[model samples]
Target: MSASQAAEVVRMGVLGHVPPMSYRNAQGEFVGYSVDMARAVCQDLGWTCQWVPTSLATVADELKQGQLDVAAMSLLSTPERRSHMLFARPYYTSISAWVARPGVALEAPGTRVAVVQGSAQARFAQSRQWTLVEVKTHTELAQQLAQGRVDGLLAPMMTVVGLMAAQPLQSLQLQVQPRRDPELTGAASFGISPMRPELKPLIDGALERLERNGVYDKINSRYLPFKVN
Candidate 1:
């Protein structure tokens, strides 16, 4: 391939801390359900894939600034976000839940809730006028909940479950409220940079092909206990 052609490969950004979905491992490699799916899509299109590790707090800005070609992290489609970037076809269903110690009133006035910055849960907390303890990553959000620094945590249900099984949190007996917030429940899709409008069709087609060929299901099963699509 020519230098210009090689340079045209997609620069996909992924969260560095959200495990089982998209994260950078201990070995410094990006591996997770989202990463696998992105790779499959790029491979199908015969496009080189360059993975960029990023935090959820900055991904949207990065995309809007053209610093990244695609946001491969589990980004939920929202009207507010749609104004900043384009989203590919929906890949998975996203639902968020509240986690807290038993007997803690999550809906009480001035209840401090921890939420990952730039996430849908954060917006939900803000909309409800809940005191927000904004965090940059899922690991920090989990740490705040485990350390009792926050009254509750509002995050994706699957992410909450994954973090609960990790260190510094596994022993804590936390109550997970059922997901019911319409703002936090919706289809998650890849956020394509507005600068790369051409990527929308390419990524959408690749994802559709993967789904039809069962590759999407295989990747989903490899990382999650339940199907997200």
Candidate 2:
């Protein structure tokens, strides 16, 4: 393809999260790491990038329909996902964790862990032998924890930390250990549509450059909530 064709605008889907990516500010603007990273790539290529909000369950369908060129949201690379879409080299590693209300200890066999259905955390919980109660979203799991619907929740350690900081839940706590299988760590990578093979290299190269230059570290630091426990 010519340089102009390569620089054509792409519609990148994203999800709302903490600042420096796709967070909804008090003014209600969506911004954060994924957004900044996507924006940087667009600026470098002089391309116009559009952000589409989507849930994890529907991203694959959207990509398949060609409604999206790429997905900036984080999803684990499973054989199932690989069959339908391509993934960029990992941009961030989210430590999977078991979170619970303060004072409730989480044990392998006896603990009831709430997880988002079809999420990495849910899969990890299954592998770890936790009794799983599948919910729809991280926020929903948090609600269950608040309501005593379950013993604890499993999710990315960073997300647990961020939630604790932003919500200041005295009951919520997180436990993280090195993943035993290594492959189950559930680190995040960008998902690309198979139809847009060209966009993969363009976006992946920009991500590689950003990681090498410490841009990603800075972005993570800004969003990661510091926890004492």
lDDT of 1 by residue, 109-143 (tens): 89999998888999888988679999888999888
Per model, state how many residue pairs clash: 0, 9
Residue 96 lDDT in candidate 2: 66
Model 2 lDDT-worst window of ten:
172-181
Worst ten-residue run, lDDT, model 1? 1-10
lDDT of 2 at 123: 64
Which segments of candidate 2 are over 4 A away from where they belong? 1-7, 17-21, 102-107, 126-131, 168-183, 225-229
Residue-level lDDT of model 2, residues 1-229, one tens digit each, is 3689556878888776533335667886666666666676677666787778776667787887788888876667877678778887777665566666556666647688888776666766777666788876566767777677788877666556555555534444544443334545655777899889887887778878777887776666666544211
Local distance difference test, each candidate: 0.86, 0.68
lDDT score for residue 11 of model 1: 92
Model 2: how large is the Cα RMSD against the reference? 3.7
Give residue 97's error in model 1 in angstroms.
Answer: 1.2
